[model samples]
Target: MTAAPALAPAALRVRGVTKSFGDLAVLRGVDLEVARGSILALLGSNGAGKTTLVRILATLLAADAGTAEVDGHDVAAEAPQVRESLSLTGQFAAVDEVLTGRENLILVARLRHLPRPAAVADAMLERFALTAAGRRRAGTYSGGMRRRLDIAMSLVGDPPVIVLDEPTTGLDPQSRLEVWRTIRELATGGTTVLLTTQHLDEAEQLADRIAILHEGRIVHTGTLAELRALLPAAPVEMVQKQPSLEDVFLALIGHDGPPATAPSGPTAQETAS
Candidate 1:
């Protein structure tokens, strides 16, 4: 009798993740989970320790006292497998400006030891709509195109999970939308994504579920509708204050610590550097 194939674990799983640098605590016992092929937007402002949390999940930085797993592999114990299962794109696109778009993709493919790097790059260029710009130096590409190419490079090995921290930070609205469409397509292909962004509308647009991180803790997490359900029933005068999400965030989270260390929430790596 043939044994049934084992079930794939949750695409991303994190529990009690805490990170501190000197006197500053960056993440305070964060607990979260993301299912396979879903997009979870981690919404937080500039000093909310979002980048610190991302680094921990990607194995780029270790947590002080907690465990995290990617694709069922423990992040700390199985760093190699965890990294292989996920690709990370930080606030800025990690592409070589001097290299042509094709060269950039091929370089990453080779780095990953994928066979036929040229073929892999070509496929990725096509997949990301960069085929027309394949031979152009990445620096010459527009903001959106460069970002797409960066993402294409990350996809060269088809990692099952992708971590994007502020992927649309500096893009025009149209460029932002273009990236949004690309993200949507990736999820459709069964790729799991954990995206960190401060933009409320972006969260509404791209996430299957939204998690709001405040002062090193997840204050709330749920589907857009589910999150909306947390609000008091509408009738402006009845509630008194405005119904903005900022209001809701503060309301749900309560008045916590002073939004983490100020001036853009530096991670331990940043401070050590």
Candidate 2:
């Protein structure tokens, strides 16, 4: 019998991975894959082990069983290789506060052993819209500016894959939107982005595919539209001159439906019909 053709290397592949902390199991036979240049958003409620899964992929934590590959490098055996091929941007900005934005970038470039560190730093400062503030201490920069610098630092080596854990947590609305745009551009430029976020809207906007984890296991995983299809559409509240039942409901209850719009909630008559 002829052997099956070899499968193409995935940007990231986690197979039956399990992790435990004493009596608690953080990851239970979890399996996931992210294709090259695509965005995968891992969503979960608190304590669902989203961060644990990310840590495992980033080689910051070991799994009790199974294996994972990042950019064709085994996460457990080839951890250094996996670390070299991937970048991790955590919830807090990791840039050096005492260093100027340019200095921070240069430091990272030097660590990555990029030729002409100053030139690379200059280019990155421009790319991240930080040229004006490149000479200023990162400690003095605004939240958005600091976050941008942190992300820019992560790009010093131009790694193929980036794992972001809540890259936009405390930023204002406009700043959050800006970060979203940056993520889009990165994916467009052939970077595989795997991020974890609590923002449903962010996932809806940025994720090519989303996996919702519940209790350390994947409860839902699909394109946003597919996930939406699984859940009924909520009521459409309209502003009109005449009052209707929906209007009365809104006036009395202050919402057309529950404040938390869940996928399994009842569908609006208009949408259900």
Candidate 3:
């Protein structure tokens, strides 16, 4: 029998990845693979160590055990290669407040040693719809605009793998949608993206594969269809009637309402003891 053709190298791979802080174990034998030219969403509640995992992948932190690779280069042994192939947007947008949006982009471009920093910065501002505000200080921009500039800075080197950690956290709905469109376009253009987000809808919309990180370990990983199929189907409620009080409340408050319910059973702490 003929063997199957060797699979193309994955964009990123983590095997038995584990991390700890003294007595506290954060990541416990987590294994994940993100394929080239796809979006992999890492979903979890706050304090689930999603950021920790991304840090390891981005070469910001060292794992206590197991192995990680980016673009066929071992993360530990080939740190520079991994860094060169990956871009990470931290949970908080990190634009320099003192710098104008254009200056920020140019600075990053220069750091990446782009041949023409001004041209590259101009192109990025145009691509991210920030050309209008490019001359303003990042501190003066709206949250969404600042976030967009922060993301634009990360693309200076055009890394193949982009790690976006909650890139849309403070954006308005329209801004969030715009970010989603940009993410989808990147994935379609053959860039692998690994993202961590609490927004389940965003994951369902953009991720080719979804991994639910529960207590640092991946409890679920699959395509949206596969993950959704695991749960009982519930009717999506869209009303032709006038907006309900809840909708009106959210509209007036400019925020999603309080969470609907609490966990039904014992907490993880109770379960562990």
Candidate 4:
């Protein structure tokens, strides 16, 4: 009989991840896993330590306690390997304003020592639908175009995992939707994406799984349906309701209606226990 094959490890893994500043604890024993080729959204409010957790995962900050691994490499002990396996696009677009979009990508590819950087850069520009704008300086690009270039730069390394920190925070509605489509395409193309977002609707539209971080810990981790299940069952009623302005706007823009249902079970604060 043939021996069974071993399963691949998760794209990202964290155990007992803790971080603090002086007397205040920002993260209290957080743990999570992101499967390969899946999208995981880390949902949190302001000052909920979402950014801090992302920084640690990207190897920008050291966790006071606990271990994190990316593509099977320990983040602390094998920083270079971890870096090689993941790319990070922070809240703000990080492209060089003076360089053309194409030049920015080529510069990143060359820095990563990729052969044929020009070819790689062109491919990325085309992939992100920035081919027309590729020749223009990043400083002249619109917010959406610059954001796409920023993400394209991250992909120049061809990393298996990508970390996006509130990527659409300040974008207009149309720009935000464009970025959302781009993110969905990334996951569909076999990239593991871990995104932090304050927008519940964004999480609902993009994530395969959602993890809620409150105070410091993940209070919930599941799909939209599972999260909805946590709420108390509503009584049957027959009532006609008119559509709200938000619903009309969503329909106009071809957006799916509504964010996740409100959770009446233990709140994130209650679930911290």
Candidate 5:
């Protein structure tokens, strides 16, 4: 008898993916994979091509060369299937300010052709802790509320993969923590999440695996401890105390010391950077 086949594809896969704009090359032969129900964080400074790579995977921008797949569907050739498998939340909230939080989710559900759109909307509001604010117009919602509503709307399609590009930007400490909890819950619910963020602490807090993008290529990829091993030994003076997450991050990225902390709560979960 033939051997049993594997049941599911890698949640995401990319091979030598490249993108360019005239003389400027944004992605250079990028390769990575993410398993189902896990979180992979893509870390980079501004212009490191994190967003460009995400756009290619999301089918918002076509790659100039190489290939990508979402749940085994080729992003370029099977664009519709790729889109059907993934939901993208960009840096800015994408909900309609004029609509109530509930209405916003219902509209998204209806657009996705889900039956019982109102029911789906209500469920999402409750899941995101927006049930109490469901009736308020989104225009009057705080930044955090709008962000939560935006993410809830993304789930209306119930895709298997979620792509978040700087999803926590501009959120207050409590709001950031709330978003972090929501992200963790998504992974716990068996959804694959690919996140791009500049916050090193955020990546350390939540990523199962982390990839660093620099100069249009993936410079390194591994679990936090593995990445830390790539760094040179700290000076004896600096080693008098146990190194912090920021130390590992700075060491790997070749920075001198920790950057200024954002006005945020403690790291949501601890892991080596």
Candidate 6:
């Protein structure tokens, strides 16, 4: 795809995207928009069709109805072009276990036909802070390191749009934080990101906006503050301010960055139908 999105004020646009299998419907009618260089979290629960919708946008699956576009390329008609404009990192780390971390990066670089794949791989390894583990088999790396390497590989071509589906689902607290930091850095560097998550705190911490997908439709769309306004503040009680788990976790780990404002729960709770 062309770099039109960078200067054309483009966005990841989805309109009435729907899908189904036999009699079971997945995405009924979903719509969302992630602006250029910003992060939008598609908040939902299991069976919410978030993955199905993502697959449609990624051109891995065809939609029964509606359309999706990125950087002026239609997902159906201009699939190849749309692909050029986007990068996808799924729910799990898509790394080669047998390959070393550096080798994994080099493999992706070569697939993208980047010049001097070794140099590109070296840069990626250093960027993800995996230089020391560059020679280690990816399967031997810690969960956080493996996730970082996966993300690093995804960014090789610097696709203007990226879709990450529950990137930190099974990670430990520290590893989750590391992946969170990486995602924030991605948006800060001007890549439009669309990520799906069940965690409310994740949406609060990462997204510029949140779209709560429920029963196959977007029931609400807004920033954390806006969504929080939907529910009245917790009675403004003069009660003790107990530190949250996230607060405790960060304090114990000394992690630097904005702490998530949301309490732990499925993101669907942040909004209602």
- Across 1-273, the per-residue lDDT of candidate 4 in tens digits comes to 998998889999999999999999999999999999999999999989999998998899999999999999999999999999999999999999999999999999989999999999999999999999999999999888889999999988789999999999788766676788799999999999999999998898899999999999999999988998999766554444444564566678776634223323432222211
- Per-candidate TM vs. native? 0.83, 0.84, 0.84, 0.88, 0.84, 0.88
User: Which 10 consecutive residues of model 4 have the lowest summed lDDT?
Assistant: 264-273
Q: Report clash pairs, candidate 5.
A: none
Alpha carbon deviation, residue 170, candidate 6 (Å): 0.9
Better by TM-score, candidate 4 or 2:
4
Could you give the candidate ranking by lDDT, starting with the highest? 4, 5, 6, 1, 2, 3
Q: lDDT by residue for model 5 over 1-273, one digit each (tens)? A: 999987777899999999889999999999989999999999999999999999999999999889899998999899999989999999999999998999999889888999999999999989988899999999999887888888888888789999999999998655676688789999999999999999998998889999999989999999988998898765432212344565466567665433324345443533333
The residue ranges of model 1 lying beyond 4 angstroms of the native Cα positions read 1-8, 236-273
Candidate 6 ranges beyond 4 A from true positions: 1-9, 246-273
- Writing each residue's lDDT as its tens digit, candidate 2 over 1-273 gives 999998768899988888899999888888898989999999988899999999999999999998999999999999989989999999999989999999999899888888999999999999888899999999999887888888888888899999989999898644565677789889999999998999887887788999988887887789988987997667655333344553465457554332222233333333332
Query: Per-residue lDDT of 77-136 in model 6, one digit per residue for the tens?
Result: 999988888889988899999999999988998898899999999988888889999999
| Candidate 2 collision pairs | none
What's model 5's TM-score? 0.84
lDDT of each: 0.86, 0.85, 0.85, 0.89, 0.87, 0.87
What is residue 203's positional error in candidate 2, in angstroms?
0.2
lDDT of 3 at 37: 97
**Candidate 5 deviates by what RMSD?**
7.3
Instruction: Give the per-residue lDDT digits (tens) of candidate 1, residues 94-184.
Output: 8999999999988999899999999999999999998999999999998989889888887878999999989998986456657887999
Query: How much is the lDDT of residue 229 in candidate 5?
Result: 88
